[model samples]
Target chain A: MILAVCLNPALDVTYAVTALRPGTSVRVRSVQRRAGGKGVNVASVLHQQGVAAIVTGPAGGSAGTDLTAGLDSAGIGHRFTPIAGATRQTVAVVDADDATVLLEPGPVLTNAEWTAFTTSFADLAHEADVVTMSGSLPGGVPGDAYGRLIGLAHAAGTRVILDCDGSALIEALHDAPDVVKINEHEAASTTGIETDSAEGVFAAAEELHALGAKEIVITRGAHGVAARTGQGRFASTPAGTVDGNPTGAGDAFTAGLAAAMAAGLDWPARLRRASAWAAAAVAIPTAGAIDPGVATDHETRTIVQELPA
Target chain B: MILAVCLNPALDVTYAVTALRPGTSVRVRSVQRRAGGKGVNVASVLHQQGVAAIVTGPAGGSAGTDLTAGLDSAGIGHRFTPIAGATRQTVAVVDADDATVLLEPGPVLTNAEWTAFTTSFADLAHEADVVTMSGSLPGGVPGDAYGRLIGLAHAAGTRVILDCDGSALIEALHDAPDVVKINEHEAASTTGIETDSAEGVFAAAEELHALGAKEIVITRGAHGVAARTGQGRFASTPAGTVDGNPTGAGDAFTAGLAAAMAAGLDWPARLRRASAWAAAAVAIPTAGAIDPGVATDHETRTIVQELPA
Candidate 1:
């Protein structure tokens, strides 16, 4: 079973408007809302793949309740710790051609709330084979929050898949998570290395490894994923470009990696699987959803290439 | 006691972003949410003025829970009927220079929910001196919903002030609400007569009177309000331009009208009081909030003119 941790979940609201015009009142044609966060998307993908996964994090207020209810409606298992402040919300105003998103700063948790969530995470991690923590930490949480969770997951004998960027990624690398999943932009910005080429990606992965990650997975959208594992370095790219919404493609990649690791797949196989899942995610409109037919077709079509050590 | 009926209340969410750029993601600097709708705004203004006003309407789902919570936190009285569908939400994305509002179509009420709300409204109106029904009716509600409510309020010996637009306004006029508060745009659009001039405004008011409105009050931004009452034709304009958000100015006007009627004020006095409140509302940044200092200053400065009947 996988334990997916989403510390900064939101009630993702999508408003379909005829057109997005600045400084004007627009009547929305329809509204769609659901629980969303990177980790939540990972759990949803895992659940859709028939994998046993439970969502664990802090949820509070009306948005929190709505988030949990959304999970329930989706048949995704969640055991979120209760907090005092309301969860954050993200609004996406989608017109015919593009979407504009407004993201709110999530709730600030007290020390007590953080402690309670960590306690809950510890318990959930103990019962899981793999734990995947994703997304940004909410306000008032310790900067090395993912690092602390990595320690707890390791203590519970659970392999941790850390998917985040910036300082959190930098801070958690010291905890030596089993797998670190990041997109190319985050990898480039974090290590100050251009990841447009294979050598640059490997160089960035080497830096991350030196900092303490056991395995590094850097995803380049459309170009595919490059990874450095204990076995060797490898890259996987999709056969063709799939088009739709790329919002949760990375989360789907993390879900695939976690699933492959739980099944004890090799590094090359995990890379291929993760790339296929990401392709499937992009073929769907909403986050936390994948096209199963697309996933199956991509699984066979995605090519895994070996790189020199 | 005034019963403020908000048939289509919303959980108004405001996001303050650095700037609004279409097709781009913007991080919101702050988020502010509260119970909102025209009637909710009316009730809030009435409460701020120390008037006894209770908000009554059908509220459901998490947004509904949040809406009611907001009302409670503001110390406003409410007796909302519970329903199965969730209330709608309105998002206002404010940047440095302007605001862009996205209005969602509110929830659809079942026949049972409508019956339940009407029952509650009937009971509440029985004990109230005035009933102010404001805003657009939600889907599935009868077009003549306000007309029926007017009949109920009248039967209970309560003066009714109806504030709505389009067909809902046109249909309700048959019931002869004691006061019909409408803005210049709504009035012009409903009557197909431009309300840019005093003559045009009076002509529109005359048309509304012919359609069965006992007293027609037309509010023109900056220029102030014009009315056709049983006593005579009158117009009240604020002494100076009150530059701020005009979003809820009309609701504040409705509140002022309701409060004055509850106090047994005549046409001219009610127009003056409502104009002062509307001016005060324009001074505040948020809807459902009025500046007491602004209200006091405007009350003395607002000039009422007795138009030749």
Candidate 2:
């Protein structure tokens, strides 16, 4: 079984309006809500691809109730540790030429709540063969929460794929998960290097590896993705720019990578599948919504090249 | 005791930010939420003044749960009829010199839910001496809901004060509640007349009275207020403008008007107290948070002049 950890989950609310006036009232034309957070989105993509994954985390209050019901309706298994604070909600106001996001701070996780989750995480990690830890840590959580979880997963003989950024990623790299996934911007931010070109991206990946990351994948928009590991390095290049919503592409890539690892696919085939899945994801409108048929069509067409290490 | 009916209650969520840039993410600097709707605000005002009032309406879903908890914390008595749909939420993004409100279309009230509320309304109306019905009706509720409620109140020998506008007010005017409170703009719109001057406001009030309203109170903002009834006509001019948040001034007026009616005060005294309370409400920062001390200071000092019949 695959375990996905969403430390901070949210009810993603989308409001459609004709125009967003600054000082006046706007009657929302329509509203759509779904359960969201990086790990949850990844798990959603995995479920759509007929993969088995459980979304686990700390959820609380009324918003958490909505998230729990959302996960259930989507047919994704969840074992969230309940806390006293309310979960957060992310609002996106979509207008003709604008998609403005208003992000709320997630509920603070108390030390007791954090301790309780660590116990749950240990047990779940023990049962799972692969674990993916992603998403932000709610306020009051330690910066090295994912690192601690990675350590637990390693102790249980389970492989972990981590997708986080900045200080959280830096801290988690010390524990060294099996795979680390990030975009070019996060790679630059985390490694303190300019990743504007291929060489810069490769250098950043090597830096991450030296920081204890076993395998590194850096996704660059349009340029596709690059991976560097102890074995060698490989990069993927899509046919061309596929125009669609790029909202959940990263999560889809994470889902693809984790599923590929579980399926025992080699690094080259894994990169190819992850790139194809990401392209398929961007071709859709809704976030975390993927068409397996489209993914299959793109999978055979994407090109994966082995680069000189 | 007063019964306040809020047909469409909401969780008022305020997000403070430095600036709202479209097509980007805005991190909320702070967030404040409260139970809000016209009648609920009126009930809150009454509760703050140590008056006995019960706020009753149709509430449901998670947002309703928050509203119920918020009212409980404020020491307001309430018994909201439960429904299946989620309550609405109003988001206000506060930027410098701007408060952009985004109003969510509230849940559709099923026919069964409307029937359920009417049953609760009858019980609450029978026990109360006065009933105040205000605010918008959620989608699917009849436009004349307040008219039906007014008939129920009148059947129970309870005086009714209605604070509504547009088609709802047009339909409810047929019930001839004791008082119809509206701002000058709403009065002009409802009466289909231009109320830009004192004569226009008086004419509009007479038109509403002719349509079966017993007494009419038209709040003219800084120009103070004007009133017309069978007894006579009176106008109140406050000492001066009291600068503060003017969001809930009308609700404070409704509460004061009802309280004065229960005290058996005449029209002039009722108008005076209502105006004073509205000023007090404006002197505070939040809606429905009137300082009783300020209200008392303005009550005896407000100028009430007898006008032509």
Candidate 3:
């Protein structure tokens, strides 16, 4: 079983409005709440694809209860370490024009809570085929927390996938994860590259790989993704712009990659599956995962164009 | 014991910022979440004043759980009737200039849920000295739902205080509540008089009293309040401008009035106490009730000037 750890999970609330007028009250046409955080999102997507995954993280207060209940209802196994403070909430106000203003950086967690979470993580990693550590560390958690988890997962003989940004990503890279997934901007920030072109992104992925990541996957919204492994490099693009929402496309991509690897698929096949899931996720209105029906059709129709290595 | 019902209670979130810029992200300096909705605020204030009040209403989802927890921690008695939908949340983005943009009209309530709430209201009214119905009825609830609740409270020999606006307030007034607390705008809208002058407000109050309300209290911010009872009419002005957040001043006034009447205080003393509470509530940063330490001194120093009979 794959184990996903989200250090800073949140109660994600999305409000769809006709328009977001500043300093004026606008009625929300629709509102949805879901369990959020990169690791949680990855576990949810895997569950959608008929894979059993356990999601572990620090969850507290009423929001934590709701998150647990949501995961249970979705048939995703989860073990949450209860903390003192309430779980954070991220509000996404999506306007008619598809512009989203995200209120993020939720609640803080204490050092003792972080120690408790790491202890829980160690126990869960032992029973997992792969361990994915995702999202930012909450306040009071050490900056190198993810790096420590990567080392712990490696010691447990489990493949580790790191999906985070900023200083945490930099620190984790030193520990050498099996796979690292980052978006275009994070790739640029970490590699000090400015352009978002395929060549520039590929060069950045090479830099990341040299920095200790065994494999690097760069997600370019709308343009698909580029992955570099020891075997070679491959690029895949979706059939078309299946427009809906792109809130959790990256998480979906990570889930697809993990699922394909768990099934012993080759690198190219994994790229195809990941691209398909990411496309489907973007086309779905929901935040975290696409429906199985949509994921299946998208996977079948997805086209991967391998780049010359 | 007093029972307050908030059909559309909310998790009132206030974010204080330097200046609110549209289409741009802003970091909030301070954040506060309180048990909101007029009825919930009333119950909180009454509880702070050492009054035994039970708050009952529809609460569901994580937001509802937070409200319940807040009331519980504050030692306020409450029983929440679980509903299928989550309670609404109101976000106030307050700038340094003291200007606020309010997002109101929270979540919708189903008809079956509304009926269930009325049943709960009736049960609570049987043991309550006064039943206070507050806030806007959520979508899907009939406008006459408040009227039905008022009638039920009356049948139980409980004095009813109706604090709402628009059609809900209009419908409840037809059922003749014991007291009606409204802002100047709500008073004008219900009575069809647009003047902000005291005499104009008094004319509107007289019209509302004729509609069967025993007492009408119109709160004019900074200008104190205008009250009309069966004995006579009196308007009181605060000695100075108590500059602070005024989010729950009306609710504080309602709490003070309810507590006084429940203790059999005379109309003049009740009005004075209510004004003091309102002043104290506004002078505090957070909404709803004031701290007892501050409230006591404010209540003593409050200068209440009586208008002509």
Highest-scoring model, TM-score? 2
Q: Order the candidate numbers by DockQ, best to worst.
A: 1, 2, 3
Specify the highest-lDDT model's number.
1
Q: How would you encode candidate 1's per-residue C-alpha lDDT over A1-309 as one tens digit per residue?
A: 999999999899899999998889999998888999998999999999999999989999898999999999999999999999989888889999889999888899999999999998999888998999999989989999999999999999999999998999999988999989988889999999998887898899999999999999998887787889888888887868998988899999999989999999988788877888888999998899999988888888888888887
Please identify which of the two predictions, 1 or 3, would achieve the higher lDDT against the true structure: 1
For model 2, name the residue pairs that clash: none
Q: How would you class the docking of model 1?
A: medium
The residue pairs found clashing in candidate 1 are none
Clashes of 2: 0
Worst 10 residues of 1 chain A by lDDT: A266-275
Model 2 residue runs over 4 Å out of place are none
Cα displacement (Å) at residue B297, model 1:
4.5
Candidate 2: tens digits of C-alpha lDDT, residues B138-215: 888898888999999999899999999888988998888889999999999888989999999999998999988899
Candidate 2: tens digits of C-alpha lDDT, residues A1-309: 789999998989999999998899999988888899988988899998889999999898778998998999889988999999888888999999999999887899999999999999999998886899887788988989999999999999999999998889989988988999999999998899999999999999999999999999999989988899656898888856678899889889889888998898899888878888888889898878776766887788888889875
Given candidate 1, what's the lDDT at residue A165?
A: 88
Q: lDDT, candidate 1, residue A8?
A: 91
Docking class of 2: medium
Clashes of each: 0, 0, 0
